[model samples]
Every structure is written in C-alpha cells, then in structure tokens.
Target: MTDPTPGRALPLEGVLVVACEQAVAAPLATRHLADLGARVIKVERTGRGDFARDYDTVVHGLSSHFVWLNRSKESVSADLKDPDQLARVRDLIAGADVFVQNFAPGAAERLGLGADDLRRDHPGLIHCSISGYGSTGPYRDAKAYDLLIQAEAGLVSVTGTEDHPAKAGIPAADIGAGMYAFSGILAALYDRERTGEGTTFEVSLFDALSEWMGFPLQYAAGSGHAPVRAGTSHPAIAPYGAFAAGDGVEVVFGIQNEREWERFCEVVLDDPGVATDERFASGSARVENRPALHGAIDAVLAGLTGDELVERLERAGVANARRRTLDEVLTHPQHEQRGRFVEVDSSAGPVRTLLPPITFDDGRTPRMGPIPDVGPGV
Candidate 1:
C-alpha cells in the first residue's frame, strides 16, 4: 500500500525512536524500524560504543552480526551512569515516539530509563525493554544467551541426534525476541494513535523462546515421554527426511498424508502394494516402521540422480527439495526468479542482501541503506 502520508516517505517516516541498546535482540528490532523510515537514534556508551561491534572482526574487519543488525541508525554516545547522560536521555526520550532499552533487569531502572519512570515524564512515549528475562520470577536475573535460552527452552533436547543434542546453527532465541520486540513496538505505536496514551512493551529472550517450545512441551506432556531426537527426520511422520542419490547428492522430501503415501509408493517407490502393508498402513504405523519404509525408498532413490528423483517426485505431487549450502543458495535459481536480492551499502562497501519477503501491489521496493559506524552512527 502507498503510504497515505505521500512523498514516498517510508511506513514510519515521521516517527522518532531512541534506543538505549546493545547486542543482537534489541538492536535488530530497532534497526528494522529504522529501515521502514523511522529516525532511529541509538544511544551507546561513550568511547567503545556497542560491545557487539568488537565481538568479532570477520565482515571486512567489522563484526558481521553488528553490521547486519545496526544498520540505518544514528549513534549518540552517552554514559547512562552519568547524570548529564541521564539528563540528555530524558531530553531525547521526551521527544521520542518510542524508546527501547535492552539492559538487564534493574539496570535501566537504576539509570532512570525504566519504562514506568520515562512514561511519567512523557505520557505519550512508547517504552520498550528487551532483556534476557522479564522483571519478575526466580530466573529473571540469570544471564541468558541465545544458545543458553535454546537449551533452557528444550530446543536442544529435540534438535540433534538421539545420543547428543545440538544448538541450532542460527541464533533462534535472539531472533525470536527481536521479532517480538519489533512487533510489540508497532502495536504500541498504533495504540497511541487511538488512545493518545503510550504503553510499555517488554520482551525477554527466555520468554520468547519458551513460547516457541509449546509444541514439543505439549507432545511430551501428552505422550508421557519426550519426543525422539531423530536427526534430519520427523518425529510424527515416516519417510520424511533426506536420502542419498546415485550422483552422491542429498535430497530432502516429505509426505503429509495417506494420499502422498499412496503416490510415493506407487510412483517413487514403484511398489503400490507397500502402501497397504499392515506395518505401514497409517501415518502412526508408518512412523513405527520408519526404518523399513526408509530403507525401501532409499533403495529406489539409489538408482536415480538427485535432479531426476526430485523431478519425478514433483510430477507425482510429492514435496521434495535439494539441500543447498549457503554459497550455493546465494546464486540459487529461485532467488532470481522471485527477485529476492537487492544491493545494500555498508562501511565495508556494497553487499547484496535478500529483500524482505513481503511483496506489494504497487511494487515499490523498500530501500537497502548502509550499515553505520560506531561513535557517530549506529
């Protein structure tokens, strides 16, 4: 939709945000708002700025994660511990439509940036706090990281092979908290328009990840046991995983229901009778005999190349995909077909990034601006 405000202003053009944030979750959330046209002013500690900027020197001598999350933001250095800095923040917060802070519980409050204190001064300012844990409860003060949250939330327990659990390759918990914080800010912004009153929003890494664990939690509670850690395999379905092809490539495939099972047995496995075999007759039964069923399908796939097997599976109305590495995915045909890539500028120079997944009727693409530097720009 064309922004009703005109002049091609982004969705949040006139909004002013002040973020007292560091690290991944909060910065990522505020950065996205900046991308959508908010004037984001990131408040950082004087001298070194966000510590995440020095977490690594991998992306053209910059922290890869920092550059990716802190783009399109202006930086202002202020020591929250100092009276002058605190006063300056109050001044900034007074004018801000939204104020974000990801400091630990009590930290923002100690510095007088707590949502309650700030809201009293600026009744219409939306205050958001992103923390490792919420303000209350026993574990609220516990140090939490993405991997730690994943483990605490039981994601690790079901992710890897049966013998050993592994953390997800990406920072799922951090990303989840960030996304929630971003959406929470948006909701608060909308509410302010109607009520003429601002609200406080809080997102914790542990809480965000815990909500995501509901499926496995319910399954374990109902089943009277934990879900099996079937690496690259589904817990509730059979013959749903990757298999080796004759050309030494791997292809992942899935079967959702009885219809797909029938199609697989008849076309892919070339054995219609296998569909009605007592041990593999139903979804639950197939899951019980997954080993035998997988072996049967593997034997057939062993004779066909990965490309040929995928083509045949698609023609038979089965879902199948080839597993590609990050490098391979960069130049994948689907990216060009879907126009998913766009060029973005950074201190390191220009880089290509995947565009936002959403498409518009007017086809006006969002901007891919530069990642800013420390000291002066976030």
Candidate 2:
C-alpha cells in the first residue's frame, strides 16, 4: 500500500482490507473503509465480477448501484473454485490487517476462508463475516436479499400506506448491515490496538434491520399493537406529513410540541382559535381526530400557494421542508452550499458523487479513488 502524504493522513491510512464481497452489503463496508484510506482489495468472479455491475446501465453504461457503492477500491478477478485462485485469496488474507466476506452460509468454510481457520493462522487479523440471517439460526441458509430481509425484519409491515405495505425505496436492509459491519470492523481495529490482538465478528442483515426496528418493535410490545402504516405521515401525530398548496407543490411539516402547534394554527392557518378547538387541543386528541384536523388545515392551506405556505411556516418557526423529488434533491441548496458534491474517475468516465457524510475537523478529505475495472487476480 502507498503511504498517504505527510500530515494529511486519513484515519485508516495504513490498514489493508481484503474483501470477498458482492452486491451491496460487503461492498458498502469495504467502500467506507476505502474512503477512510484503507487499501481495500475486492475479490470478484473472473468473468462478470459483481452481479450488481449488471443491475442497470444508467451511469455511463455502468450499473448505478455498483458506482454508488464502489469507489476508492481495487478490484481483482478470480474464480474461487480453482485451487490456485483460492490459495491466492488465502494468501492475500493472510497478509491483510482485516478480512471481510459475505459468502453464503458455509461457502467460506468450503473455500478454507472461514474466520476460524484464518484467525488461527493470523491472530492479528480482524475477521468480519456479514450474512443474511447469520451463521446460526433456522434462517441461516435462507436467501436473504434486501427485500426479503426487510419483510422478515418487519420493516415492510410498518412502511408505506395502510392499504399497501412497501419495502423502503432504498435497500434499507443491505445498507443497515453494511454500516454495522463497517462500524464493527472499526471497533475491532481499535480493540486490537488496545489488546494487541485482533477480533472476529459477525453482522447479519436481519439483526441490523431488527435493531433499526427497535422503536416500532418496542412500541408494539408495550402497547399491544403495531403502529399504523400511514404513508409519509406519522401515525401518532396530527398535522404531520405532506400537504399540497394551491399550485400543487407539496410541503411536509410536523408540529412537535404544543407551542409549535399553537404557532402553526395562529400564523400558518391564520386562525388562533383553531389551536384551542376540542379536537385539536392536545396532541393525543389531534392524533385521535387526525382526519378532521387535516381537513381543517387543508381548508385554510388550499387558498395559499406553496411559497405562501412556506413563508407562513417560517414566520411561525415551524419546522418544514419541501417534499422534493430526487432530481431536486440532487441540486439541493444545502448540498451546493456545503460543497458536498465531487467528481471521481470511474471506468465509464468521471462521475459525480457526493462526499462521504463524515467531515474531518482538520480539513483532511477522504480518499476519492477511481472505480476499477475487473482485473486479473492479484
């Protein structure tokens, strides 16, 4: 691995990560590591590499999913079924500071790349295994795609409208597992520094998403009922969610407290007495009579343009935002003002991408390396 320039080193500058990854979860984890300056060597199949590379051709003939997840990483093509290729991968892992894999259940062991076997030989290696259900459990070998995991973890049950439950627009389960794996690997690295020994860990999409469903799960457990699936609206809050103006522009806002609620009625609704109405007096009362409350708000808002509604909300100190489309979000003023967007070289060409969410106080930027084409085995 090349050394980072002096006095501008990233957090994981010297770390070497060898990842046998595909699809979203493992790629995302390694990509984050690569962003922080880890030397990530991604192992892929000899021919097509990652299947996600064929998910779509929206980004200059490259898959949007692949481009979004894989940056600042090196790719190596290998047929793991071949003994020589498998041996080379094992050798690479033997020298790596961290080894990450998301192989199907028992696949790693079959290839002699299992955490137990590798860690036995290299105690200083951080071994992380990301899977669908986990190494154990009845669902261990079950096919665990993003939607499947979302359904199994009850995310779909709580998402979308009451009439039609929906998976999240994004791959929530895959992202959750990827982030957890990334963090778990970071923690293990730190632990190694303190104890002089590396660690073994596992992160499953099911567990990650189940942890994410903590609030709804606890709510159901304590209240003896699941929260209602209100599309883009809160089940327990009234006057929350999207509202259309006279010009048909959508605005989303939420009233978090009685003060805000009162202000919303007086300034935005232009009716102070509405705040004291029996159906809307208390939070619970408003939620209980949400339909009537929405009707009241809609009646007042129907006459106002989107700009007028936004102005009133601002005057009332009500937290609000436009229900922006994906294209609008790409040109959002916040991102533009913050200089979040950047260009990176890819196999297709220079592609536009947002900087990683993390910002260093010292002004050291994360690595923005090229997206590699699948190359011969390392």
Candidate 3:
C-alpha cells in the first residue's frame, strides 16, 4: 500500500549522505539520515554486496538486519580494490554533503576513503568514521565486534546474572555507536550551516559503549566495589524486579522512593505497616533486606491475577510493565494504537517496519522510503 502520510517538508530534504558501510553501526547512522529525508547512497561490495544481507533470510528472503538498516536509501555496488570503481565512489562522495564509513581499522585509509584523505579534496564534506575501537591505542586494530566491544567496555561484566556473564540480546555497542554517529553528523550539518565548512568526527563502538557503562563504573569507583549482577532485579533497590502473579504472568516494577514504597504497600499490598517497618523503611534498608522484602511482596502478589495486579499497580501509581515476549511486542497495544507500523517496498517484496520514534511538532513522521536493490547504481 502507498504511504498514507507522505511529503511533509522534512528538515534534511536537501542533504546528501554517501556511505561505505556494512553490518550495523554505519548503516544504522545513514538510515536515520535517510529517514529524515536525506538522500543516502549506500555503496556495498560488488557481487556479494553487504555481508549482512546474508545474516539470515528471515524477512521475505532478505536478512532481518539488512531490511531493518537499509531502508530509505539507494544501494550501489563497488569493488574498492578496483581503481575505476573506487574512483567512481570517490566522485560520488565528492559531491555528497556527508560521508560515513565503518570499514575495519586502517581499511578506509588503505582504500583511500579515510576522512583526512577525502577532506583534502572535498573540504566541505562531512566525514564520519565508525570503528570497533577508535583510530588510536593498542586496541585500535583489535577485532571489535558487538560482543567483543561489550566485553571490552565492561558492559558484560555488569549484565546478566552474577554466575554467568552475558552479552546483550541486541547489538547495544553497535546501536550506541550508530546513534552517536547520527547525532555527530547532524551537529556537523548544523555547524556547516553557520560556518559553511564541513567537519570530521569518529565514533568507536568501544567508546560509545564505555560512555553507557558510566553508571556501573561510577558505582564501583565510589564504593570501591563493583555492582553485583542481580538477574532481573535491581541491584540497588528492593522489590524492584519481576514477580509472578497468581496466573503465573510476570509483572516488573520498581520503587524509586519511600513515598512510592508507602503508596505501594498501602494500595497494592493493602498493608501500610510494611512501609513503616524498620528493616524496610528506607530504600537502602530495603535493598539490604531484599530477600525478606521480596518474600513479603511476593506473598501479597501471589494472590492476585496478572490483570488484577496490573490494574492495582496502575491505580497505586506504581511503574510496572508486563514481561512480554518478542512476538507479543509485535502486537502490543501501544504500538497498534499509535500506528507505529509502516510498510516499505524491498527487493523481496513489501515489508512492515516501525516508524521512526521522532514525531515533529507538525505531526509529520519521518518518511520511511524503500529498501534498495543491490547494485542499483553499479
């Protein structure tokens, strides 16, 4: 079906982005630019195209990752090793407002696609480089995939249960880097508007993830102890985890302050006395006495059905959510009500995707254009 909402004067309508990217980070960055109505020309390897296209055949014969990240952009094929094809890509970037790449460390420079190399000829072009690690230090050349960066950035250390360290279910490092690169490009674009000069910036998966690991790092530094993994529970708060209702459905909630705790006790548990108990009076005390606190809360919750528990939580002003599976989330009421799903054409066929999270004051959503066919501009 044709998009019901189309052409509402997007802000980045005149911007152009040329990307030499594969996998997650760089593609994700340019995808956002494309969503905002920028023209993004994604240059992939010849014949094979982006390897992510083969990550899986889950989306109408297209890889889920490729379908997710490559929308609203044109795909071209280039053999960077070939001088003629490399020159063609260079010519494309010379006229582009933004250039993004996530080649392995030193690989861009070897291909003469490095920021410094390009900026020498196209001084007004914004160049963004995304890598596993920044272009410096011993770890610069280290193979940095999402899992490796998660481990190296100390994210895995604070994730999962204490017994078993686990990487995030999603590519957190790659997403973080992508978001930063996206913002950096926007910033560069804004600055160019004022100064009429393009700028260069770099985003590393390790650095991006390290910024996100600040909470655990600061907690460890201040207390001279690392935060322990608490499985589904909050390490610093009591009764702030998943609890099963009488129907065996899980409801996750957190108590941020004593006022909320008192409200939760009186309204949800129907026992105001639990809030005044010396052992669980304060947030710190409740955390220190988490075992007994959870036992008490679960005792009350065990008598209520999931719907009844959630209704009570809503009435009591408690922040709570149901533990939903991925499939459940696809049919989530919020998404359905907000009309978050949109369909875009792909090489395989049409596919449904979520609209971009941002909504302009004018009520115009980002234009999610089509996924391109490989070598469309070869």
Tens-digit lDDT track for model 1 on 1-378? 113234456678899999989989999889878767788888888888899989999877888788778767888888777787689778988899999998889988888888788989889989998888788999899999898899888999989988989999989899999999999999999998999999987999988988989999999999999899998899998888878898988998889999998998888878899999998999999899888888778888899998889888987899888888888898999998987887666778776677665455564555456766765522
Worst 10 residues of 2 by lDDT: 1-10
The list of candidate 3 runs beyond 4 A from truth reads: 1-8
Q: Tell me the lDDT of model 1 at 58.
A: 84
Compared with the true structure, the alpha-carbon lDDT of candidate 1 equals 0.85
Which residue pairs collide in model 3, if any? none
lDDT at residue 95 of model 1 (Cα atoms): 92
> What are the TM-scores, per candidate, against the unseen true structure?
0.95, 0.98, 0.96
Q: Which residue pairs show backbone clashes in model 2? A: none
Top-TM-score structure, candidate number: 2
Rank the candidate models, highest lDDT first. Answer: 2, 3, 1
Query: All models: lDDT?
Result: 0.85, 0.93, 0.90
Per-residue lDDT, model 1, residue 35, is 68
Better of 2 and 3 by lDDT: 2
Q: Which stretches of candidate 1 lie over 4 Å from their true place?
A: 1-8
226-276 in candidate 3: lDDT tens per residue? Answer: 898988888898878899998899999998888899999999999999999
Q: Which candidate number maximizes lDDT?
A: 2
Alpha carbon lDDT of residue 311, candidate 1? 82
